[model samples]
Target chain A: MNSSSYYRNNIAAVYIDANALQLEPVQRAISKLTHVRPQTVTSVAEIPAAQRNLRTLYVTSFRGAALSACPGTRVHRCCNYHTVDLYAGCPLGCSYCIMQSYLERSAVTVYADPSPAITAIRAQALAAPEVPLRVGSGETGDSLLLDPLFEITRRYISELADLPNVHFEAKTKTDFVDHLLDLEPKGNAVIGFSVNARQFAVEEGASATLAQRLDAARRAARGGYRVAFHFDPMFRSGSSDGSPAAAAYRDVARRIAAAVDAGRIAWISLGTLRYTPALKAQIKRPYIHDEFVGCADGKFRYIQRERVALYRSVVAALQQYLCPQPPIYLCMESDTVWQRVFGWLPQQINELEALFAGAPLRGESV
Target chain B: MQMERVATLVQRVGPLDIFDQTRLPPDQLIRQGLTAVLALAPLHDSAAGATDAAEAQLLWGGPIVRRAAEIGVGELPARRLGPLGHRDALMLALRMEARAGGYSWSEREAIHRYAGEHRVALDTELSQLVTAAQTFAESMERYLALAPIWRRAVEAGAVDVRTAELCGALPPAVLDTVSGAGRRLSFSNRRLVLTWLSELCGRDGLHEPAAVELAQNVMQSADPLDALRRLRYPRLSAMEDRFAALQRRLTQGTPLELKAPPEFEGAGYEVQLTLRSRDDLARAIEALQRMQEESDELFELL
Candidate 1:
C-alpha cells in the first residue's frame, strides 16, 4: 500500500500492498479515534484498487505536538508552546505502549523530515518572541532512542542553537549525550527521561535500566544539559490497604532518590498507569499481558489506593533530594489526584506552569 | 345530547369490536376492514372540522369520506378525547375484521391500494408497523382457533409475563416535571446500553466475553468521567463533560484505558518561505527547492 494507508483518519477501505502480501499479515487493527478500515496490499501498483471504492484522507501526522502547552517546567524552558514528534513507535515493547494499541497500522514510521518541524518552531518562537516557547518532541515517541540511528541529538544542538528563546526538550530513554558534548549547551533546551526503579524497570518497563538512566542523566547534566525525570506509569501492585501500598510507595521513593543530582533536576513528573477500556483489552490480550500491571479502576492498571500512596511517597521522597524541591507535575491526571497527592490541585494552567517557573506558583487550593 | 347520538352511531356501526375480532378469515377481514375504514372517512373529516363547518365539509367531501358518512359514521370526536380514541378506534376495528388473518401478495396489494386510496401510510407511523400488523393478524388467526383455551388460561391466571408484555409495546416513560429518564440522556444511548446489556447476556447471539469485559472495563475506570470525555459526537466541550459524567455512571466497574490515544505518522517537513524579506524568502526557498530535488533524486535511485 502507498504511504497514505498509514495516515488516513476517516474512511472505510482496505489497504493492500503487493510487497506486504507475501509477508506476515499486517497485525495492526483499526483505531476507533479514526474511522478507517486498513488492509495491507501486496503490490504498490494496486494502490488504486484500494482507493477505487472508498474515501482516503491525507494527513502529515496523526499525533499532535509532543509538548504543546508547556506546563512551564523550567523558567528556561520555552515560554511559548511547541511540540516535537521524534518518532512513531519504540522498539522497547512496554506492554502499555499507548501507540502499540492506538496506531492501527503495524509498521513503525519515523518522520525523516526535520526542517518543517524546525521551521514551525522558529515561526512559533518568533510569533511570541518575548514569551519562552515551551516545546518538546518526545511526546509522540521516545525522542532520544532513535537519535543514534539518525544523529537527532547532534542535529538539534547544532541546528537549533541560535534560537535562544526556542527551548527544545529531548525526552528520551536512550543515552546519546556524547553526541551533544561538543555543541554549546543552550539554557533553552531541557533533557527529559521517563524513569522507574530498577525492580519496576526490570519487571514492567522495557527502557534503559536504572543505572544506565542515572549515568545518562549525570553525563547530560555534567555537559550542561538541563535534565528532568518522569516517574510516569508508576507501578502500584500491592493490596489496597496500608502496608502493601506503603511498600510500593517506598520502593518508588528510594528509586527517585538515587537517579539524578537534586540540584540539576529541572522537574519531576508523577504519573500513574491509566488507560482507556479499549487499551485495557489490548493489555489483557495474551500476547501483551504483564503481571506487574494490575487493573485499578477497570481498564486502568495500578491499584487505586496503592497509586495515591505511591504518588505521595514519590513526591515526599523527591522533596528530600531536590534543593528547592524541583517542581512536580502530574501528567494526564485528574484534579482529585493532584489534591490527594499534593494537598492542592493547581489551576489547569498554574499547576503545570510551576514546572517551568523554577518554583511552584501559588494557586487556589481545592 | 350530542354524546348520546355519537354513542348510538358507534354502537350501530359494525366495526365497534374490531380490535377484538380474531376469527375472521383473511379475505373476509380485508374486505370488511377496508369497507369500514372507507365508510368512516367522511365522519372523520366532518368531526375534524369546526362545528359550524362540519355539515358543509361533509357535503362537499371527496368520495372516500362521503361513503363513510352514508354508513352512519358520524363526526369524529373532539381532540380532547384523544387521537388514539377517535382515529385508532376505527383503524383497530378495521384491523380486527379485514387483516386478522394472513394475506396473500395479491391481497396485500389490494390492501395497499385501498389504504392509499383512503390516505393511510403504512410502516411509518409506528416503527415496524407492517411487521407488527402481520404478526398481530397471525396471532388473531391463531387466537380464533384457540379462543377457548386462551380464555381458560386467562381465567386460571396462567397468562405469563410474556403475554402481558405483548399486550402492547412498552409504555412511554412517565414524564416527571422535575427529572426523568428522558431529561437525562437521549433514548438512543439508553437503548444502546439496554441492547448492549441484553446482547451481553446472550439474548441476540452477541454474548461475547469481550463485550462483557469491555462493559466491565468501562465501569471500573477510576476517573469515572472517562467515557463522556472521549465522546466524538457534538464536539462541544460542555456536551463532552455531560456525556463523560453519564458514561462514568453507566460504565461503572468497566475496564478502560486512561492514556493519550495513538496517532499516525507522516513525512518530516514542508517548506514555507514567508520571511518578510523577499530575498530571505527567495534564498530559503531556493535552498529548500534544491534539498527537495536532491532528496527526490536519492529516492529515485533507492
Candidate 2:
C-alpha cells in the first residue's frame, strides 16, 4: 500500500459537531488518522464551506430515518433495495458524482449515530423473516473509505449477526480492509467494490488502483467474507472491434477470477453512466467526453443500442473468466435493456430479489 | 481662495456701497453686500447652468477669481482665501444671502451670461470639474436611454436584483450592446444565466479581486455577452454547436431538417425531409442514401 494513498488523502480538515463530540468511534477514527485536532463545531453550518477541490470531513449526527428505500425514480427499474446512509459524501471526487449537485453541503459528513439504523435493520429482518432483505451502506458514500478509521462495518456486522434473512453490503472503491479481516465472519455481510475501466479508474481519481482492489477482494475472500463487484458507470471510449472498454472488463474479470474462487463471489452489477438533467451543468467539461444521449427516463445515458452492446460484451467476458458464472444484474436500468442484454427480465421486483438471494455465498444463513 | 477674489471683483462692479457704509441693520447690510458681489459674477454659462449648482459654482468661480487678480486690485488679500474649505463656505454664505434678497433664477442666468462674455483663462481645477461632469452626464444619458428596457425586463420578471446588480456593474457601453439579446430570454432563465455567469466572473455578491481582472477580459472581447453565455451554459452551447454541425453535415444535398431528442433526453434522432414533387422526393431519397453511407458520423451525435 502506498503510504500516501489512504482514502482520506484529500481531506484537508475534520470537524466534529457538538452532538457527536463524545462518540468514541469518531474520536478513535480521528486519532488514528494523521489529521489536525478535530475542531468542535455547534453545527455543520458553523464550518466554513469548502471549495469543490477541498475535502472537508464532518462528523455529525444524522437526524433523519437511518434506513430508507433506495430513492430510485419511477422511470428506472429499481432493485427494491434499502440503504443505510453511514456517510453523506465521498473523499474521492469522481467527475460524474450525482452528489455534486444533489447535496447542498460540500463536506464529507459521517453520521456518528448508527444505533437507530441497526435497530431499523433488525426490525426489518424480524418483520420479514420469510423474505430476503438487501440493505447496503454505499448509496450515498463509499462504505469502506472510513472503515479503518471508524470500524463502522464491524458495528453493522455485529448488529446483523443472527439475522438469517437480512444481508448488509458496504460498497466502496477503496481497498481499505485491514480492520475487517479480524472480525468474526458473517455470511449476511458483504464487502463490495465499485470497479471500472482502467481509463476511468485513473481519470476518476479513485483512491485505490484496480490491482489493489482485487488484492483486497482476495484477502477478504480468504478471511471468509462474501465479496461483490460493481461495474458501474461504464463508459464508451474506443470504436475498434474489441474496444478498450471491452478489453478492460475482460481484464478485470480475469484478475478477480485469479484472486477469488467463483463460488465465493456474491454478485456482479453493470450500470452505464446516467445522470440527472441538473447534473449536466455541474459536470466539469473535461469529463463530458462520453457519448450520452438524453433518454426517456429524464437522464442522459448511452443510447439503447450502445448500452446493450457494452453490457453484452462485458457479460460475455465475465462468463469466460469464471467456471460457474456468478449471478449478474443491471443497476437502475429499464426492463427493455435488461431483456435485451440478459435475454429475460424478472417478472417482478421480488423475482429479481430472489435471484440475488440465491447467489452462492450470499444465501448462506447464520 | 480664487472664489473670494472673484467675490471682491463682484463688489467692485456693483452699484451698492453697503460694505463701506453699513447704516442698515446687520442682516440687511450683509444681504446688500452679497447682492453687490453676485451682481458682477456671471452665474449662467449654458453648459455651466445645465450642471448642478455645486458644479456650476466651481466652474464660474475659477474664471472670475483669475480675472479679478489679473486686473490688479490693491485691496485684494496677498493670499487667496485660507483654503478650498474656507473659500467654499464663504461662497455658499454669499449665495444664500443673495437668494434671501430675492435673487431670481432669471437674474442668475443673466449673471452667468455676463461671466461667459468676459471669460477668463480656464484654471486646472475648473477644467477637470467640467470634463468630469460632462463625462458623467453623457453616461447618465446612455443609462437613461436604456432604462425603459431595463424597467420592462424587471417588470416582466426577466431580470432579478442579483442579475440587475451584475448588469449595473458592467460598462454602460457593453450593457447597451447586450440588452437586445438579453431581452430575448425568459425572465427566470435570464436571471439564472446572468447569476451563473456572474459567479464564473467571480462577482458572487461580494466583489473579489479576481473579478476586476476578469471584467477587463470581458470588456476586450468582440461579443462579451456571447462569451458570458458560453461560460455560463457551456453544455447547452456545446449541444447547440454539435446540432448545427450535424445539420450542416446531413443537409448538404437535400432540404431535410434533422431533430435531435429534446435536450438530448433520448437516444433516438429524427430527420424530416419535405418534398414538393417527385423530383424533390428523389433528391430527398438520394440525400438519405448519402446519410446512410456516412452513418458513423451521425452516431457520434449520441
Candidate 3:
C-alpha cells in the first residue's frame, strides 16, 4: 500500500505542536494533504492516551542538538556512524520494529525544526574535514515517510549541499521520493530503502511493497542520486530443500541488478533479526513464534550456525547478480561471525567507514 | 337569660380539646406521612423528632416505613436484602439524609406532586436517590450473582476465603476502572477467566500450590488487572521479564550498541559503533575486541 493508505488506515488524527503551528507552510501543507484538521497541542503529552495507536504528527520545536553518535551497545560490533534525529516514530508497523519497546509513546512524532540538525551537521562537517562523516536520519524513524507532505528531505538536500564531507542518508521503507527527482544531484546524499524477503515485505506491514521499493531505488539511481539497500532483520525461515531465505534474498538482488546499473548501488547491509528482552512482551502475539532463540548479546537471535548459513547464502546470491559487489557490511554481528561470513574482520571501524565513503562504481548510463 | 345561655355554650365549646379539632381518622396515624416517619424511626433513637417523622413520611410513605422500622437500624447483610427491598431502604436513607432536618411546606408539596405524577407511594423530590438506589442494587446483584463462583473457588482451594469474598463482592465492572483492555472483557470472558483461575488452583501437585499462591498474590497486588494478565499469559510474561533482565546485564558498564530484532525472532543481532574521530574508532575497536573475547557468554542468548 501507498503512504496515503498508511494515513487512511492507521492515522486517526494529526496533532501539531503550537510552536510548530508557526511554520504555517508545513502545517497547512500536511493538513491539506491528510485532509485532517490540525489539532494544536502544546506538547507531545497533550495527545490523549486513548488515541495512542493513531499516528500523531508532532511539529514541535526541538531544542537539543540533533546530530549525535549512534548509541551502540558495548557487547556488539558497531559501525562508527552518526545519526540525525529528524523524526521519532514510523507508521510502518514492521513486526520487528525496535521502536515498539524503545519509544515511550506510540504515535509518530516529527520534529518541525530542522535548523538545529542542519547546524549540527555543518559543525561536524567543518570540524572533521578529513574524516568521512556518515550522518543518517533513519536512526529513530523512517527518513522519507513524511517527505511527500513535509518535503523534509528536500530541505535537507538544499541545506546540506555545501557540506561535501558529510554524507546524508534518507533511509525508508517507502517509495515516496517524487519530491527528490527534480532536486540537484548532491552526490553526498543516499536514498536507502530498507527491504526484506518477499514473504517478510508483505507480512511486516511496511508501507511499500518490495517491487515498489526496487522501483523507487531504480528511479533514484537513474536520477543520479546513489541508492542503498538494507536486507535487515533477515528471517530464518525453515526450508528443508534449498534455503528459502537464500532464494528470497537472491531473487530480490537479481531484481535490483536488473532494475538499475549495479555500479549505482552504494552499499547493501545485512542484519539478522535480533531483539532485546524488553521487546518480547511488546511483540504482537501472532508474530511470536519458535524461530527466535536467546543469544549471548542479551537479545534473541538465530544460532550462529543458522546466521552464518543465511548470510553465506545471501552473500553468494548478491555476488551472482552484481558485477562488482558493493560494500556489504554485517550489522550488529561479532568478529567471529564477520570472519566466518566475509573471511576477515576490519582491524579498525574507520577502515569500513572509509570503504563506504570512498566511491561509487562507474556504470553504463541508464 | 338568652345572653347567659349563649355565654355558657361558648365556654363549653372553648373547653373542648383544640388539638382534636381536625378529628383525623385513626388510620391516618399509619397513613403515608406516619408510615414514612415510622420507617425511618429505627435509624434514630425511639424518641424521634417531628423533622425525622416528616422526612421518613415524605420519602417512603406508610407501609415501607413501617416495615423498615420493624427491621430495626443496623447494617443489613447483603444476602438478607432483596433487590426491591435494597432499593427502597437505600433510597429512603439517601433522601432522608439529603434533607435531614426537614423540608419546607412548598418543597413537600412539590415532592407530593412529583410522587403523584410518578404514581409512587412516597413523595421523594430527590432524583439522585433513584439513581443511587439503582446503582447500589446493580452492584449488589452483580456481587450476589458472582457469589457461587467465589464459593466454588474457595471450595476448590484455589483461593482463600478473604480473596474469594473480595472477588465475589467486586463486580466485573471494576475491571473497567483498572485497565483499558479490562474494560473490553466480555461477560463470558470474565466468567471464563474466573473458571480458569479456579481450575488452576485445583490442578495437581506443585502446580496446584503455585496456582494457590498466585491467586493470593493477585488478590494482594496493587494493580489487580495487571496481575490477572500475568496469570493469564504466564509464558509471555516470564519471557518478557527474562528479556529485560538480559538487556540490563548486556548494557551494563559499556557504550557498545546492541541491536536485536523486535521480538528476537530474526537471525542476526546488530552491534552499532559510533565514532567522531580516528581515536574514537580505535577505542571502539578495543571495546569490540573485548566483546569478542567474551563471545562465549554473550552468544548464549542466540
Residue B181 accuracy (lDDT) in model 1: 26
State how far residue A179 of model 1 sits from its true place (Å). Answer: 2.7
Which RMSD values do the candidates have, in order?
23.8, 17.3, 18.5
For residues B1-302, could you state the per-residue lDDT of candidate 2 as single tens digits? 22244445543432111121222224333323222232222232243333112222321223333344445532322222211232233233334333322333233233323324435222333222333232323322333344554544543455643356445544333334333453355555555545444556432233544454454555456765677666654555676687778678878667787787654444457988788899888888888887788777665544
The segments of candidate 1 whose C-alpha lies over 4 angstroms from its true place after superposition are A1-82, A202-205, A238-259, A285-306, A347-366, B1-302
DockQ score for candidate 1: 0.02
TM-score of chain B of each: 0.22, 0.35, 0.30
Which candidate tops TM-score?
2
True contacts kept of 3: 0.07
Candidate 1 CAPRI category? incorrect
Per-residue accuracy of model 2 over A1-366 as CA lDDT, tens digit each: 443346446667788888887887787777776755678899778787453233677888767887997776546666657899897887676777888776645677788778889999899889979777889999998898877778778889877978887878988888887688888847578889888777666545656888888889888888888889999878765322324476777778788899988888878888988888677656643334344556655778865666788898988888899876677888877666776777676543343557444332211231
Which 10 successive residues of model 2 chain B have the least lDDT summed?
B15-24
TM-score of 2: 0.56
DockQ of 2: 0.07
